[model samples]
Every structure is written in structure tokens, then in C-alpha cells.
Target: MRDLLAITKAIADESRLRAVGLLDGRELCLCQIVEVLGLAPSTVSRHMAILGQARLVESRKQGRWAYFRLTEDDAPAEVHDALAMVLASLKRDKQAKADQKTLKAVLKIEPEELCRRQSDCKC
Candidate 1:
């Protein structure tokens, strides 16, 4: 019951759901997701945390960067089904389409460059 509740709560928000959609089949660095969603890095981190708790996403830290991807292959059936539902329902959503378009450009920028740009850093 707790797992179900967490999964439902994790995907309850539009931002989180969109984040999941963006991660359907690709791994993304935190900065890339921040760029696509136009949200603060901290905010996106919180969203990722929730999704992680729900077993909907997985993360790996390499140095200072964190990469996230949708949980698959080993995720519970419910998690997979929920994600499928989200992807199917939002396939034609205007916002989702816009995000994907923006994501193409976002993906072109290397992760380190994206982080530097986000932080307005010269390094």
C-alpha cells in the first residue's frame, strides 16, 4: 500500500510526469532536465527524489553530476504500466511535444557545458 501511494504521489504532478516522459528511454543529467523543464536545479532534484522513491526512476552519481533514467527491466509491473499510461496519454499533448522539441537542443549541449551555462560560471 505504501509503495502504491508513493507511486501515485510521485507522478501526481505535471512536472514530474513530464520529467518521466522525457526520461522514457534515455538517461539525462540533472542539468539537461533542468534545461528542458526550465526549472531550478534544486526543484528538479526534489522531483527526481520523489520519482526515485516511487521506484519510477533511478539515478547514478558520477563526480558532481547525477544522471536519471526511467526504471525498467526490474521495476514492478505497476510502475511500468503507469509509465506506459503516461506516455500513451501524453504522446500528442502540446506541452509534451514542446518539451521534446526543446529537449533536442538541450541534448546537443554537453552536460558540463549545460551545467556551466546554468550556473553562469566561467569554469
Candidate 2:
């Protein structure tokens, strides 16, 4: 029950949902997600942490970088079902479409470059 509640709460936010959408299948470095969402690294990290606690996503550390991907193979049935529902529901959303487009461009930038750009931002 606690896990179920956490999963629902984790996905309640728009930004977190979008992050989940971006991570639907592929693994992405922290910087890539940061760039796609245009959010501070700390903010995105917090979002990912919530998703992690829900067992909706998993993270790995490689050197100084962290990468995240959907928790497919071992995710509980509820988490899997919730992910499917969210993905299907957002497939045609306007903001999701824009995020997808931006993600394409964000992916083109090397992870290091993305991290550098993010660190240099004054906003």
C-alpha cells in the first residue's frame, strides 16, 4: 500500500511524468534528462529520486555520471500498468509532443556537452 501510494504521488507532477515519458524505453544520462526538461540538475535529481523510490525507474552510476531507465524487468505489476497508462494517455499531448521534439535535439548533444551547458547556465 505504501509503495502504491508512493508510485502515484511520484507520477502526480507534470515534469515527473514527462521525465518518465522520456525514459520509456531507453537509458539516459542525468544530463540528457536535465537538458530535455530544462530544469536544474538538483531539481531533476529530486524528481528521479522520487521515481526511484516508487520502483518506476532505476539509476546507475558510471564514474561521475548517473543514468536512469525505466524499471521494466523487475517492476511490480502495478508500476508497469501505471506506466503503460501514463504513456498511452500522453501519446498525443501537445507538451509531450514538444518534449519529444526537444529530446531529439537534446540527444544529439554529447552528454558531457549537455552537462557543461547546464552548469554554465545562469538561469
Which has the greatest TM-score?
2
Off by more than 4 A, model 1: 120-123
Indicate the residue-level lDDT of 85 in model 1. Answer: 89
lDDT minimum window of 10 residues, candidate 2: 114-123
Q: Estimate the TM-score of every prediction.
A: 0.93, 0.94
Which TM-score value belongs to model 2?
0.94
Model 1: how far is 81 from its true place, Å? 1.1
User: Which pairs of residues collide in model 1?
Assistant: none
Q: List, residue by residue over 24-89, the lDDT tens digit for candidate 2.
A: 779999898889888999999999999999999999988888999999778889999988998998
- Stretch of 10 with least lDDT, candidate 1: 114-123
